[model samples]
Target chain A: MNPCNHHSVSIKEMQKLCVSLVPIFNHLQPTEMEKIVHATRSASYQRGEQIYGAGDTSAQLFIVHRGLVKIFRLSESGREQLIRLLEPGDFMGELALFSGSPFDHFAVAMEQTELCVMTREDLNAFIEQHPKISLRIMEEFSRRLERAEKLISCLTSEATEQRIAAYLVELADEHAANSFTLPMSKKDIASYLGTTPETVSRKLAEFQENGWIEQSGQRNITLLDRYALQNL
Target chain B: MNPCNHHSVSIKEMQKLCVSLVPIFNHLQPTEMEKIVHATRSASYQRGEQIYGAGDTSAQLFIVHRGLVKIFRLSESGREQLIRLLEPGDFMGELALFSGSPFDHFAVAMEQTELCVMTREDLNAFIEQHPKISLRIMEEFSRRLERAEKLISCLTSEATEQRIAAYLVELADEHAANSFTLPMSKKDIASYLGTTPETVSRKLAEFQENGWIEQSGQRNITLLDRYALQNL
Candidate 1:
């Protein structure tokens, strides 16, 4: 699939869409946001497209204007471990820019995704000129570190059932409703929770049998017992 | 232990000692560094002292000038999962400063440790005044995030023996020598690698039997064949 063919977005359109979408630039004046937009190039990725994979040396920041991205790393045996998901307003590739190191993970678009990209030199210069951006970047990093640490705790401490239950509850909370669509595939969920697809499916079924959740097909899940899931 | 009693050093002496210790402040001019020192309080922790733990509301940054610190999270069943260790020139508690979230893990002094402490508000004000500090903070965050991601990959994808092999290789690389003392305990290493103490002990012995390593007690290990471990 041609990622660009899916959405032929203009530079001005992307600038207006992404300037306010990016957390760092949202606080700035329109003129200042325009200055940052000038440094970026608009791009799109089709669903399941390999946006960038391991060993990519490009130090360009990919800011999600729309759609989803899954960042993951693979084992020597070709087993995947999902790192984290990036939604609209989230960005990736900052680490490579700072460390001058090749990316050790892969990023894939989960849906038709729109992005604004800026090169390392340009983004570094932008942060230098507007120091507030650096503060925002630090805050973003702190948030990500906290999340990564939480995942470590989950992978090490929590059981498979609890992991799935917690994820469902989290999604319900995010939606502020009992019913919500799954954000990622079961395989991806299994990878995210450090389990296999069969284990994920088994635990999910057990949750359903216990009346903690209701499922219509694989994606639509409604939480019937939030308290139980939370306790789990 | 009284954090201050172990270090009765004068404020001037502490300022001089710590001005060159913290990574963020080391590059600043001596006068500028002294300005930051004035904003910090000098404190010390005895061996095994609990510096901070989960749910602690204090939002003060702790910068280690000497000795060691360990960061970990506890499972619901009271099992400890070591996150990472902190040593000289390392700092903690910045997450609270940025997110206003209580710490979700525990931090302890592994030895009698001297530190410089700065409250979140003070550090925020300092960063505002010295914007380059924000850049440095971003760089530090990038480094830590990269580490956290690597750990996630290790815990999810690698087997226990492989994990042990990788850790040994890492420690060797850090020391730039074939022989080095283990910076942490086997139990702690197990927690860090998401395994058990018995498994860690077994793996080390296996590596020894394979002629890949030589060991005297648990603390000292010499890599006889770095290539074998690297290939492991």
Candidate 2:
């Protein structure tokens, strides 16, 4: 499905949307934000479209304006190892902004997606002129490093059920609501947690039966007791 | 063993040493480096000393000048989830430099260690005055994030032996030599690779018997055939 065909937005509206969701630019003065908005271009991707791939020369920063994007690497055996899932207000392809290196993973649209992209050259120049913007970017990177470290810890020590529970808790916090929808399918969640779809299904069902969480549908989950879920 | 007692250096020498190892400082002009040198203080820790713990207020950035430091977190069952081991020229506690938050893991000396410490306020001020240094630090953080993501991929899709092979390849590349000493013990390697020491021991034996590598000691291995190991 071509999202742009169905829901078109003007260039000015696109710029405003881009400026509003990008955390680094949102805190800036109106003039500063306008400068960035002018530099950004909006693009759309169909579900399963590749935004970028491993070994590709990276020269743009992509901010999700709508829908979901999956960033992952393919293992030697052809299995997908999920690195991160970019939701609205989340950005990707940041390593290129500083390192000027080829991307080490592939980014694909998990659903029909719209994104605002700014060229690396432009962004770097702006950062040079505005050092505080660079500092804000650093804070974002620090948060990502912390999340990556936590995922590593989960993979190493936590059991499958515990990993799922922790992941749900993380999602709840990210969404700022105990009752929310899962962004990805159970199969994707299984891959993200380094397990199988069968296992993820079984675990979610077990949680439902145990009264720790209530599931209204396949994607809708409400945390009945966060403390108990955490203890798992 | 008291490394500082046995081999002492003056404050001037210590400051110069600290300035030399930190990548950001090394890139700055000598005068700028000197400013940082004056702000940093020298410290030492014995083997098995806890440098910091989870929930500890993080106020200083630590640059390892000598010996090894292990960053890890403990599960409720007391199982340790190893994060990363810091060697000479590598720094830690950087999240505090930007976020002003507590550390989420424990940092401990794996051996008699010497370090240079800079308070968060001083470092932030230095970064503000020298913006290029902030870019350099961003590059370092980017490299770390790349490594952590690769580790996550290894944990998910690689078998135990494959993971060991991949880690050895990484170590070889880092040292710029096919033959080098492993910085950590077998138990530590097991923890880092998400496996057991027994499994690590068995895998090394299989590799040795297959003529893929030569093990001189528990901590020294020569990669006899890089082509063969890469295919594993």
Candidate 3:
């Protein structure tokens, strides 16, 4: 996949695409979005391609234009923990722009993915010219911090079963339905939930036994009793 | 204690004070710092004062001008976890600024403290007017996020003993000395380390017994064997 072809689209069409997909960009004027769109360069990565590794220079901020990405770190024991999953419109590397530090986590393309990349210098310049955009970026960073805090709390306090249940609830809420397909494999989900695949499998079986959820296929999960699952 | 001494200080004085304290402000021209300092209002809090509670609307950004403050959250069982401690020149209330939501943690004065506060509206206006300042603010937020992530990783992976050792090492590093007084009490340390007071007491005693550290008093600790502690 090549992102250069995607960037060949008309600036107006790009602005429309950005506004339609990115919530923060939605409030921006078309002219402002056009400037941003023009400044951003698009790139594509194959599945398992390393978008950036831990300790890479924090030069640019990346927005997933399409496909999935996993941001994670490896423990001393070499176990991978997926800290976050990025879908289309989700932004990564903003933290690096602010800190001036190298990337702390490895970001890998979970699938062939398109990314809109903007250098920190250009983005900072744009933000300097448009303070409102800075405010939006700040808001986005704040939300991400809150979510990260919640994840930390869950990882520290919740049991494996509860973690799995919470993950399901979160997926359901984000997807806006009781039934949804898993974006990542079981192993990925297990790592994300801070447990093993066996534990995740057992928990899902328990949920099914309790009539809280129904597993139709490897990737498909249907919440039969959301309230019951919530209690868990 | 009330902060309304109403002793008006010149912007020049404010700039000088800020320059000596915050490294981020050190790079700014006197004129820039003067504008920022003039915008900030000074306030004081008595020891144990609730500067802000979790869920309180975030109206201002606070920079600790003097003394210590603790940021924390209470678990469902009423167990408090000290997320981080702030010293002079450190900033807080940023999480609220970006989220446009009530604070997620409670901030309390650990000692009689002075703070320089700028309303969120004023800060936003300042950032809009000076994009470079926005970049600095983003840098601060990024540093915070990095620290939070490291803390989370330690909490998830390290044992209680390892966590305590790590905390001591961190304290030593930050204070730039092997010997330092703990700003918070043993109970507070226990909460911060996600352990019990008894556990903290035992661990400290063990460290002392093993000649890794020495206790001069209840709060004063000296690292006697840095290598031993680091290896542990």
**Which residue runs of candidate 3 sit more than 4 Å off their true CA positions?**
A1-22, A25-34, A158-162, A181-183, A207-215, A219-232, B1-38, B207-211, B224-232
DockQ of each: 0.67, 0.60, 0.41
Fnat measured on candidate 2: 0.56
iRMS, all models: 1.5, 1.4, 2.3
lDDT of 1 by residue, B202-229 (tens): 8889989999999998599999999899
TM-score of each: 0.91, 0.89, 0.84
Evaluate all candidate structures by whole-model CA lDDT and list the values in order. 0.81, 0.80, 0.77
lDDT, candidate 2, at B227: 81
Candidate 2 C-alpha lDDT tens digits along A158-227: 8889999998898889889999898888888888888889999999999989998999967999999898
lDDT of 3 by residue, A91-182 (tens): 88877766667787899998988788888877877876777777776667667777777766666555677778988999999899999998
Chain A only: list TM-scores of all candidates: 0.90, 0.85, 0.88
Candidate 1: give the clashing pairs: none
Best-matching candidate per TM-score: 1
Best to worst by TM-score, what's the order? 1, 2, 3
